[model samples]
Target: MWCWLYFYIFLVISQILYFSSLFFLFKVMDVFIEFQILCFNSVNVEMAVFLDWVSLMFSSFVFLISSMIILYSKSYMVKDKNLDRFVYIMVLFVLSMMVVIMSSNLVFVLLGWDGLGLVSYILVIYYQNIKSYNAGMLTALSNRVGDSALLVGIALMMGLGGWGYSSYMGDFFLDMNLIMFSVLIVLASFTKSAQIPFSSWLPAAMAAPTPVSALVHSSTLVTAGVYLLFRFSNLLSRESFMVFMYLSLFTMFMAGLAANFEFDLKKVIALSTLSQLGMMMVIFFLGSEDLAFFHLLMHALFKALLFMCAGVIIHSVGGCQDIRYMGGLVQAFPISSACFGVSSLALCGLPFLSGFYSKDLVVEVFSMSGMGLFIYLMFFFSVGLTVSYSMRLLIYVFIGQFNVLSLINLNEKDSSLMLKSMMFLLVLVIFKGSILGWMSFSTPYFIVLPFSMKLMTLLMILFGSLFGLDVLFSGVGQSSSMFGFIHFSLFVSGMWNLPVLSTSSLNSFTLNLGKLYLKNMEFGWAEFYGSKGGFNLISMILYEGLSVIRNHLKIYLLLMWGFLVFIVLLAIV
Candidate 1:
C-alpha cells in the first residue's frame, strides 16, 4: 500500500467492501465497538461507530481521496528529506478524520477532532518557517475555539443523556436545555467550518503543503465541523440556526470576493473552498442533510483534484505560486492544464459536472423553501464570483502571453505519481456528480418557482463568465486594483482579518486581564493583606514586645499580676 498505485487500489477495494457491506443491512444501525477498559459504571464511554448510507459514503470518499493525496505527495514531496515524517503526519490526519466520521461517541469524536487540530498544526508548520508557524498557530487557536465549544456542547448533551450520538434519539430531546445545546453545537460548527469570524484561519492554513491544503480544505479538518453539525441535526434546527445561516451566507460572499482578488494560487483555491463550505452550511440549515453531505463528498473530489493540479503548476514553475508570474501554461503542460480546467469549471458548477449535481439542487431547494430573498441573492452572487475567479484564474495562467522571465526554462515535471493521482480524481470530477445524485436521492428535490427566478442561477453564471473574461483581458490585473474597489478588496481578501482579530483581540484581552490580576491580587493585596503579611506583622510584634519585656521584667510581671487580680475580683463578684 505504500507504493504509489498500490495505495489507490487498496483504497478502492476498501471503499467497495465498506459500501457493499451497507446494502446487506435493511435499516439504520448504530454499532458500538466498545472498549471495556474505557468504561466507568453505566457510562460505557465506548468506541461507537454509526453505520448509515451517509457515513458510509463520506467515509469511503475520505479514504479514496486520502489515498490519492498520499500518492500525489510521494511525488510532490520526493525532494524533501523529511518525506517520511510528512507521510506519517498525513496518515495520522486520515486516522483522526476517520475517527470523526465513524465514531458515534462524542468523546471518541473529540479524540479524533483534537487529533486533527494537533496534526494540522504540525503539517501547517511543516515548512518550519516563521510564516508557517504563524499560520499554524492561527489554524490551531481558531479551531481550538470550536474544539472547546464541542466539549461544552458534549457536557451539555450529557444533561439529556450519555455522550453517544444515539443517546440523543427518542426521549433525549425532552431532557435537553435546547437553547444552550443547540447554540453551542452551532458555535462549534461555525469555528470548525470557518463560517465568518473563524474564517481567517482557513486561508492562513494554506501555508501548509498543497497536499495538506487539499486534504484539510477538501475532506479532513474544515469539513469536520459541517459533518459534526450534520451528525447533530436533531439538536441544531432552531431560531439560533438562522444566525449561522446568515453567517454562512456572508462567508460564501466574502470568500468568493476574496478568491477573485487573491494573487496566490493556493490562497485563491483556499478561498474557493471556504465559499463551498458556506454553501454546505446553507444546505444543512435549509433542512437538506442529504444534499449537504452529497455536496461535501463531491466537493472533496473536485477540490482535491484542483489543488493537485495547482501543485503541479506550482512545482513545474520553479515554486512560483503567484498567478501574476504565470501565463500560457496550457502550451507547456497540456495534461496538467487540462486537469485544472476541468477542476475549475466543476468548481463553477458547470452543467453535467460534479458540482452541478449538488450545487444546482441546493439553489433549487432555496427557491421553493420560502426563505428570505437576501439568502437567495447572496448564494447566487457567490456562485457568480465562483465562476469569475475560476475564469480569472484560467485566463491568468492557461491563456495569455507568457509572463515569465525569459531566461527561466519551464516545462512539465511529468511525474507519473502526480499525473496518475490527478487522473483518478479527474475521473471523479467528471462522473462523481451523477453517481452521487443517483445514489443520494431516489427522487429529485421538487421545487416550483417562476421562470425568471429559476433562470437567476443561469444568468449569474453567464454574468460571472463575462466578468472573468474582462478580468482576463484587463492586462495582468494588479492585486491593488482588483474588483475596482481597493478597500473592499483588502477587507474581503483578508477575510476581514479575522485571524488577527481572533488571535490578537483574544490574546490582548487575556494579557491585560493577567496583568491586572498580577498587579492587584498577587503583588498588591496578596503581599500586604494575605497570610504572609499577617505572619510578618505577628513576628515583628513578638520580637519587639519580647525584647521590651525582657528588658523590663519587673514591669512586665507587675502588669501580669494586676491583670490576674482584676480577673479574680470580677469572678468573685
Candidate 2:
C-alpha cells in the first residue's frame, strides 16, 4: 500500500514538472520572438556554438513530447512493481533527449546522444527477462556503432578547422572536407535510424515493455538520427545525398513489405515506424529539411498514440500481441477500437489527420526535386505498401472474427483512467496539424486538380487495403514454402558476391610462408610450459630456436668470463 502511494506521489510530481517545463519552453520561444534574437554569441573561447531556428524547433518538440510521454506513462505504468525505477529511468531519458536537442557543441551533443541510448536500453530491459535483455543489448550495440561513426565524423570536422556546431552551419560551406564528414555522418544516421540491415533490431526490440515502445520507438529516440541529418544538411555531399535518398527509399519499401507479413502488433508498428523514418530521411536528403522536421513532429503524435493504444489492448488481453489472435474487439472494447481506428487512419496518412499533412508535404517535396520518374514511382509504390500493412493491422486487430477468445477471456477489465490519459494523445493526432496550420513553419504544399495525384494516391491505398484484406482473410497470397530454390540460389550468389576480403585465405597464405623458413625451429617449449595444444606447438618452435642460440653463445660467455677473471686478478695485484 505504501509502495503504491509513493508511486502515485512520484507520478503526480513528475506530471507537474513535465507540464511546467513545457510552459517554460513556450515562454522562452515567445521571449525569443519578442526580443528578435537571431543568434547568440559564443560562450566558449575554443569553440563557437550558436542557437538557431532549427535547434530551437527541435528542442521545443523534444521537451513537449517527452513531457507528454511522462504523463502518459504515469498512468500506463501505474500497477507495475518497478514503477519507481521506471519513472527514474524515464526522467533521465527525457533529460538526455532534451540535452541532445539543445546542445550546441558536438561533445555535449554526443554526451546527450549516448546517455539517452543507455537509459533507453536500461528501460527496455527493465523487465529483466531473457528476451527483453537480449533485445536491449542488441539495441545498445547497434546504437554504439552509430555513435562511434558520429564521433569520428565530428573529429573529422574538427580536423578540418571546423570549431564545433557553429562552423558546420552557414558560411562554412566552402570547406571541402565537409563532404567526407557528411558521408560518415550519413552512415551514422543510417544505423541509428535503423535503415536496411540495422533495421532488424527494431522489430526485435518489441520485446520491451509497451511504454518503452511508445516512448522510445514511436516518438523521440528514433527521430534523433533523422534530426542529426537535417541539422547538418548544408555539409552533405552530392554522393552522400544520393546515397541517403536511395537507401531511405529502399528501406521504406522493404519495411513496408516486412510489415505486411508481420503478425505481431508491436512489430508491425516498429516496421511502420521504420518506413516513416525512411520517408523523413528522403525528405531531408532532397533539401526539404523543414518539411521533414514538420513531418517528424506529426509522425511522433500519431505513432505514440498508436503504440499506446496497442499497449492498452495488450494489457487488456493479458499480453496476447499476435494480431491474428485478435478480432471482434470493436464490439468488446469500443473505446480502444475507436482509438485504434483513428490512429490507423492517421498511420495510413488519411486527409485532415496529422500524418496526411506531413506525408503529403514529403511527397510534394520529392516531386519538386527533379529526381525523375523512377524515384517518384518508387515512392508511390512505398505509399501503397504502407497503406496495405496499416490496413492489415486495423482489420486483423479490430474488425475480424475473434479467433483467440480463450486467450483474452473477456472477463479481464479495461484499462484505468491513468492508462486512458493516452486518449489526449489520440485527440492531438486527429487535429494538431489542421488547427495549427503550416504558417508557424512554412505553408504545406497544397496541390489541387480534378483527377489529381492525391486522388490517385487514395485510390492506390484503397487497392492496397482490398489486396491486404484478401491476402489475410481469404488466403489469396499464402505460400507454404518459405523460399523457392531459385530465390535461395540468388540469395547465396548475392552473399558470395559481397566484396569483403577472405580473412581465412589471407591467414593461411601468411602461415604457409612462415612455415617454410621456420620448419626446423619447432620443439620443447610446449612440454616445458604445459600450454594448450595449439599454443604449445608454436611455443615449442620458438623455444627450440632460442635454446640452440643460447647453447652456441656459451663458448663466447666462457671467453668473456676468463678475460674478466684476468682483469680482476690484475687489479687486485
| Candidate number of the best TM-score | 1
**Predicted structure 2: clash tally:** 2
lDDT of 1 by residue, 451-536 (tens): 99889999999988876776566533356334565446566667777766778777998899999999998888887898779999
TM-score of each: 0.85, 0.75
Output the TM-score of candidate 1. Answer: 0.85
**Which residue pairs clash within candidate 1?**
none
What's the lDDT of the predicted structure labeled candidate 2? 0.69
Could you tell me the TM-score of candidate 2?
Answer: 0.75
Residue 96 displacement in candidate 1 (angstroms)? 0.5
- Each model's lDDT comes to 0.82, 0.69
Candidate 2 lDDT by residue in tens digits, 459-501: 7688778656655664423353232332243232222222122
List where candidate 1 sits over 4 angstroms from the true fold: 1-13, 21-42, 406-409, 471-487, 511-573
Q: lDDT at 316 for candidate 1? A: 78
Relative to the unseen true structure, what is the C-alpha lDDT of residue 36 in candidate 1, on a scale of 0 to 100?
40
